[model samples]
Target: MTEANSTPSVSLKLLVLVAILVVFAVVIVLLIFFLCLRGSRSWKRRKLAVKHSSGSIPLVSKEIMVVKTSDLTPATTSEIGDVEGDPKKEADVKVDIGAVTAGKSEVSGGGAHRSEVSVEDPNIGWGRWYSMSEVELATRGFAEGNVIGEGGYGVVYRGILQDGSVVAVKNLLNNKGQAEKEFKVEVEAIGKVRHKNLVRLVGYCAEGARRMLVYEYVDNGNLEQWLHGDVGPVSPLTWDIRMRIATGTAKGLAYLHEGLEPKVVHRDIKSSNILLDKNWNAKVSDFGLAKLLGSEKTHVTTRVMGTFGYVAPEYASSGMLNERSDVYSFGVLLMEIITGRSPIDYSRPPGEMNLVDWFKAMVASRRSEELVDPLIEIPPSPRSLKRVLLICLRCIDLDVVKRPKMGQIVHMLETDDFPFRSELRTVREKDPVSSHADVSIKVPYPPPKHAETVEKSRWR
Candidate 1:
């Protein structure tokens, strides 16, 4: 009986030792897990601090963020590389596109869901990435029937989205060396600007050697087509419609020149780049050649890229571009609108081939009436028309400093009391071939009762 009791005691001691070992093992595992958890928390805190550091990144809306290629999934990275060419090069290209700060809330089944869409980089705002398949489907596989326009930049197609929204898709050519750079420049330039008179960039698709830009579709065609298209002589654009186009276009340029933090100079401001909406509201388009002027800088020196006849003399000669350069182009457009003639017409007589030269000759000879378009059914008030002509002359002046600012031009167009009227009249009278002996030309129309109304109705 004593031996049996001793055996039970030994067995109890063994059981106690085994239980102790198991407890020790469990404690070690818990300690390791806790240490790992603490390390992970510290790492995450460091990352957050870096991301939120001041001045390192520009502040974007909470919902929108810049995306970096390195942060993208492997599949996305490969796709982007294919569309944009060298992935490293594309990443190096800095585009400051805007992103939405908040995502749309959706209800699925019986639950409310909020989806988080984020970009990889936070310095530049977000640019929506469109898959190739989506683009193709929207464009009907880029069918020939969908083609709207084509030029050196690329072919533009009318695309209908799944949401039934219409968009203009520009498929850039692949072989041009500057295509990628132009794409980035256009995306960044138009992305930052929001104006009723400026075309809006909807999204972009870059997939393996294919680069396409999506833009909000304007119902009516571009100004070039209306002005010079094969449409017969009985064009629908009346004088009032033409004036509206000019004023709207001027407002757009003014905004680009003065409204933004850094002024944008649209290097190409020809009729071809001005698109019209259903209401004949004009919006500036194709910012591929646009240049931004910083607050401290007056001009940027770059290679001149614009149409032959519409290019500013100063810009074309010296390769120096500024707001004044665009003013010159607008002056040409103004002349085109008044006379219903292209800036250059090879079919015209040699002396009249260039519209600017013809205009100067006509103005010098006091035959300004000859410049009016015969197609105009209801001409503007004589005084108003004279003011517009004088403004155009001032804008296209040989001396860049003499050109009026876009804002000033807008004011002059709305009001008959142009600040430079006396100076322009004096210059006209001093011409050796002046037709009239008297220098006094009275203002035909009385000034508007409410001068401020001009500003409010037109510019504001």
Candidate 2:
């Protein structure tokens, strides 16, 4: 009887164990089922995103709200910075340092195009442009200290006013093809658009031989300065900062494409044209070659104008200009930021002359480690870096239609935790080698929306 009773107890324990095991199996199966369902939903959302991105004005998450720096209230205006240089002429300038407080004591009144037309001379009428003397004082003053930087465009200088305000003065020189057109384009286009990423056009001195655009002074300097090592040592630009700059530039470009009343296509998109704020935020500059594309029009019928390596393949082969052309250029910029090399030049690895061609092979083979800059070999995890590379693939797509919209591009960089992934750590390429702050803030534009949002071409 005792033996039989013991046997019964053992069987009862066994049955209980079996029941627990069965419950565990069912729970695991249910978990997997829900995971698969979640994955399917995500896939469907991505497909919908691609589908809805087909419109001229893409299906955006936020409604854009634009504010001119000149339009900032007096209380807000007290925060901008004053650039260095001459007094009398620079005083007329009102630089817009975007949202970052420039810390300048004063910014001039009226928007870039908001000023009233005036007639100063007896011979010329109200529409007549100013004379060289008045223009000189307005732009390049006789002072020797007014110079800022020089390039293919000519000399740039820092000009100050009697009021302690500062401005960047670009002295125009007649060098080559259609000088007047370049001048007119700056005056006309700067005459229209206004965005934080875009360099502010406080005033222009367009009187005869003295033509120059007075702009807001950028503290951190050009994107090329940091990316190309102009600021010394081949320091790796942290992946986060690079993504931030890329996102900012894309925002500015998107604004030109869809947000503006009459859409504008920045004919030129190069690293040299991108200017950085103190925080290393990239802003797209150099609108001299910008073309206005209207909603009703299919293409911009204009001259075949652009820098050599950065122009789009389609736009170069044919004169047809569109927003996608800028996308292609942005791809080149993306490649530069990734590899930390100039777009042009034959000094890369055996099969990699330009970044676009080389990046293609790497992305296809799933060998991201091969594509990153040599300076930053040990980069952040493959996931975060890979996401950046994937975005580059979209930006540099051979077919313009394949490229992601700038707004969508912004979403991917800002919202996605792509720069980080499972078991990923910092590598040289993705992390800054310098002692400076490797991390950066997201700095989202206030009231993120559709109307006034874009990637800033902040290289200028």
Candidate 3:
């Protein structure tokens, strides 16, 4: 009985040993599998780090390609070197770029070959970026002979680009503080504006401490030269030409005030700012003092900056600025155009020293014909003369609310209707009692009741 019991105990001990060995084997297998998975993960992380640190990483999905030429062409994903993609797709990229460059040269009339292509900066809006060296070459090193105009702001030089395109370059006075601000304002204001009556901004150069603006070359001179310059006694500008200029200027101002999203107040509008092209079309230039007002705002409160005689009463006195201020300046310009008199001429007699005062006095006395410029070869008729005088008076109205908008002024100037109708009570419609049939007699209105009408009015 003792031998049988010992045999059963040995069998039980063997079974327990077998169970412990199986558990140990399972634990070792699990540990080995976990270590292998951790090693693979670590290797992958190191590989990614190596790629980034070595500067071999791929670019973002969206790639930018800039074209230096006048035209812009969209580039394919494979064209950008750093971007990751199918290796086979990039084989023809170099050939495609070459073709584009060649095509640009041909299209631009074979100027200096500029093959270097890179991404464009967003800060330079709407205009090409010109290097200082390029500007210097075009202006012939800013030679004195190249200067077409000089003013407090800067000097304007006529230039011809490598492409044989004529351009006017304005070299701004580098006062450091003020010039920088003016450059920013001018570029932001007129950079993208394209109108027949507005000078076009071709490009700009802001290199080192210098600031310059390139504009389309207007062959004919400015209005100031034609109006005030020595033209051998008899002025070349006929009455009709003067009217055309006035109409064009009004249209340009209308676009600025009503057509643009953020209306621009020219701040300085005078005869000097109106440029004439080859066809005698008016182009409004020099926006150095332009200010922008949002649609939500009625006016901008800012420093009173404008020509002394052209500045409006409200603006010059209280600094309340709006589109009406520009209208006031335009009125002064119209008077200048009409009388050929400086806005403030000390040379005139005491009472006639101020053109605005003299103009109002003359009209009040019904001597409006005396206000015409003597230099004009053919004088304006009584009706046309009175209409323009009324329009001018409306623009320069002391009450800003009574002043006509630029659009209304343009319509009034273009149309022959007397005392152009407006919301202002000053411009009253004809009395209903007066027979409408009298309008059939297209004859111009007779002279003022007190004064005897002259066959041909001679300006004093």
Local accuracy by lDDT, each model? 0.69, 0.58, 0.70
lDDT of 1 by residue, 1-460 (tens): 9999999999999999999999999999999999999999999998986565443123332342223333431111111112224433221213432222223444479433322334334223323555555677799989999998888788999999777999999898766545565565676567646789999887766544456788999989998888877766666788789888999999999999999856778878888888999999999998876776777878866666777777777666666778999998999999998888998799999878878778867776667777888767777776667777777777887778878899988887877565554664675567543322122222221111221111111010
Q: Backbone collision count in every prediction?
A: 10, 52, 0
What TM-score, computed on C-alpha atoms, does each candidate reach? Answer: 0.70, 0.60, 0.68
lDDT of 1: 0.69
State candidate 2's TM-score. 0.60
RMSD of 1: 14.4
lDDT of 2 at 190: 56
| Poorly placed runs, candidate 3 (over 4 Å) | 1-125, 419-460
List, residue by residue over 176-245, the lDDT tens digit for candidate 2: 4333445555544554457888887655544323355667778777878787765444454677777788
User: Which one wins by TM-score: 1 or 3?
Assistant: 1
Clashing pairs in 3: none
Of the two candidates 1 and 2, the one with more favorable lDDT, higher being better, is: 1
